[model samples]
Target: MINRNNWRLVKDYIKYRAEIDQVSAKTLRLEETWLEHTLNWLGEKSIDQAPRIRPVFSDFVLSESENKYSSEYLRKLVSAHRRFMEWVSINKEGYRHKITPAWLKTIKLPRQPEEEREHEFVSYDEIIQIARTPIKSLRDQRIQAAAVLWFLSGIRIGAFVTLPIKAVNLDLLEIYQFPSLGVKTKLGKSATTDLLLIPELIELVKRWDQLVRSKLPDTSYWFAPLSPETGTFDRSIKAVGENRTSRAYKDLKELLDRSGLPFHSPHKFRHGYAVFGIKNFTTLAQLKALSQNLMHSNISITDGIYGMLSNGDKKKLLSSFSPATSSAPTDLNQKLDEILSLLKQNTPIKSE
Candidate 1:
């Protein structure tokens, strides 16, 4: 029941996003898919009619809610529609009058459910348990190393799977996530990321690095491909396909199964890294370093994503706070002021 004109407008908006915005193919596809849902909801009405028919948009939300779409998905759909309408208002004549900023602001989704908001992060103890699990083969060893590296470096799985042997420097505890070197970083971001200096984790990574380097050339993937017949490192296979993530995910699942541990997605390792740093790093200066190491653009981005404490942790933190005295230590007061100043500036703080 999608209107042909509306569909055409959607296509044009998608084209603009590709040619002008230059979003990643994955992001472009997601935006297109989200718009298709909007078009279906539009039915016989054109895009311009959306502003006048507010109830129709509410009906669409109700239908999606009944269909059990996640709040996150609904939020993204709203964002996509807002962007599309903004584009239409700017580029298509007469849409400026119809798709006003006020109408755009009306497009919103409700807050996420508490359960959905509370996601698990892989803990340091869990990583330790995984490391201690006996390795039965070279493949097991490789997966174990990959898990350790994922938690230590806190890079995305796409970048991890695509990392070349040369990009990792175990001795320096650094990972070069340069797109030019073919690391599939999110938004093509490039950074020389530092690995968390956990001695046990570093040792495991070192062992794997030495094995991979000795067997394969520098250009080869650090997570080397294994032979189907022998189930050992296949040095001849230098490149990985787009399906590498699927394969790597399956391997991680298998490793977790073997370790007799509950499954957490590879991306949870990233959350785990952030949570670990947030808990341990007390000063704003230390936190700034942690944020930069995670390759976040700014401290606020890092804080917004991983700053919230769990209910239990928050309770414990509040309970442990002592009664305020008439006067505080001079050094402590100075540090508190410095932290507040840096936070307000939204800039990195220098370590004292």
Candidate 2:
């Protein structure tokens, strides 16, 4: 019979090890969730019985992979068990041999196919269409601004949820994604990114900025919740407690439904921004600039993630590069930059 004490020990070890690794609560919760399934699969067997259950571990991983879990997700599940086994071996010496490298190696993780890894891109034109096909109230404007900002800045949805109005400097045409300033960037990554060099996008964002500032504190979220009675942003909302990603999704869906455009998630905006920017880039500096603007660690990482181009895009782009034709118009690029600069000057020091 399984010893209850041993089962509890393994559970406690997961929490302890997760904390030492400094993983976020979301990640820790995932680890715990996957491990619970592992325990259930090993029903009636104590963790100390790990040596006898080694084959079961291998079988379980294979079975789970065969059920069609994505390779990345399967890898996480395998990693969760590996970490737990490593912890059990160190903390509970009797199971050391069962959890050794050789035994753990028997567990197979699924490989993610290339096609399954790609995200659907939401085009800049489509975002503008969604923004233009407006609905009633300040809430509708907030949703439109959220969609525009995603394409304009390529900020992750998590960071966008907690972004403070002060971090978006319309005057400078820059967004400061700093954790110190209460922007929940990935791993607390901080960067100052210039807004997309599109005059219409800048104007759209400026209207949103002015609308929010008129009702809420600078410290409040750029996408702050609206007050039902006042039909303006609720100044009393807390800065960081709530995660509004789902609410953002619902708002976007409402807009898309009204506009007769198929619904696309907020994350698709990041993919769209990367694809649009990379496809139009004429210089290495411009390429790297896009990478930095998206908050990617380096150019290679950006390329690796967003490098895949559709065959249609490839054929059209190659045909445009004729021997008789000169390089992309430098004047057009300069004009774009100049328009962005003109809009930046309108950003008042205190955003009055």
Candidate 3:
């Protein structure tokens, strides 16, 4: 068996290829994490042990450990290993490879059952109420603006955190996702998304522009970090990310407590957008187009992710005889707005 210490070359190869091939940083990060973990576990201390990796990596991910990682995480680990090793065997000579995941048994993962995933967002009233909530400082207001932008645009959170200032077109009242600026478009393509309708988000963003970007002198970086003393932008490379996502969730949970409602996630805005599209001013073709704009490979992919309709929505689509009641008009309207906004605008989200 090859020693474990020689896996750095493979890791470096992945990182290097990902950079040149325009692969998503998120993908590279996951692959690197898995490779590192597997190498550490197998006592592989160097890059020379490329061949011995497949079995240990596969077994560790597929095996049931006491800590019990989620099936979904294991799936990622499996996929990353497969790609890296595949690259290794092809790029390097005679690295004995025996494992292939295509033949492996399917991993059973959790399905949304009776308690389906929610696509909830702040209601108009809730938004208004939130507006009235005291803002102690500029940062609080800025974060609130960022949150509202996600809801208004139905953007995925991943693209929003990395939003550069130039990607947004205040003149057009839209934010376009551009991969060149590291904006994570649906399939890493640029999208000019509609964001004009949200007066609240717009006004705050404009204020932020005057206060932050105007002075920061960084045209390329939208939503750059701000300094406390100057209130101008900072390029510390630290901004809203997964950790911010967790923090946002905690804050949202606190808000939910005040509202006496169950907490939802940052991703639900995307679902809200889908439900919105299906309900108002959107046809099947339009849905597919929207999905494509969102970087989905196919409309069916979009449906697979956000197709679970609410009971009320189902009843409306089914028939009057069905048990499901149509949802309230206003509730449906919000969903529709989100869908249409993203569809019509095709603007970039800042969550890269």
Q: Write the per-residue lDDT of candidate 1 for residues 1-352, one digit (tens) a residue.
A: 7799998999888898999988877788899998877887788988888887756554577576785877667778888877888899889998898889888887776554544356577889999988888999898999999999989988889899899999999878999999999998988889999999899889988999999899889999999999989998787876768688888899899999988889989988888888889988877888888888778866778878866766666788788788574346887798778867876775777666
Q: Write the per-residue lDDT of candidate 2 for residues 97-138, one digit (tens) a residue.
A: 666767666555545464443346787678778768866978
Q: Give the clashing pairs for model 2.
A: none
Candidate 1 regions with alpha-carbon error over 4 angstroms:
54-59, 110-117, 235-239, 324-333
Q: Each prediction's Cα lDDT score?
A: 0.84, 0.75, 0.58
Leading candidate by TM-score: 1
lDDT of 1: 0.84
- What's model 3's overall lDDT? 0.58
Off by over 4 Å in 2: 1-10, 48-68, 110-118, 228-230, 318-352
TM values, all candidates: 0.89, 0.81, 0.63
What ordering of candidates by lDDT runs from best to worst?
1, 2, 3
**Cα deviation of 61 in candidate 3 (Å)?**
2.8
Q: What value does the lDDT take at residue 91 in candidate 2?
A: 69
Clashes of each: 0, 0, 35
Q: Where does candidate 3 stray beyond 4 Å? A: 12-16, 19-22, 40-59, 62-64, 96-132, 161-166, 179-188, 196-224, 229-268, 279-281, 310-352
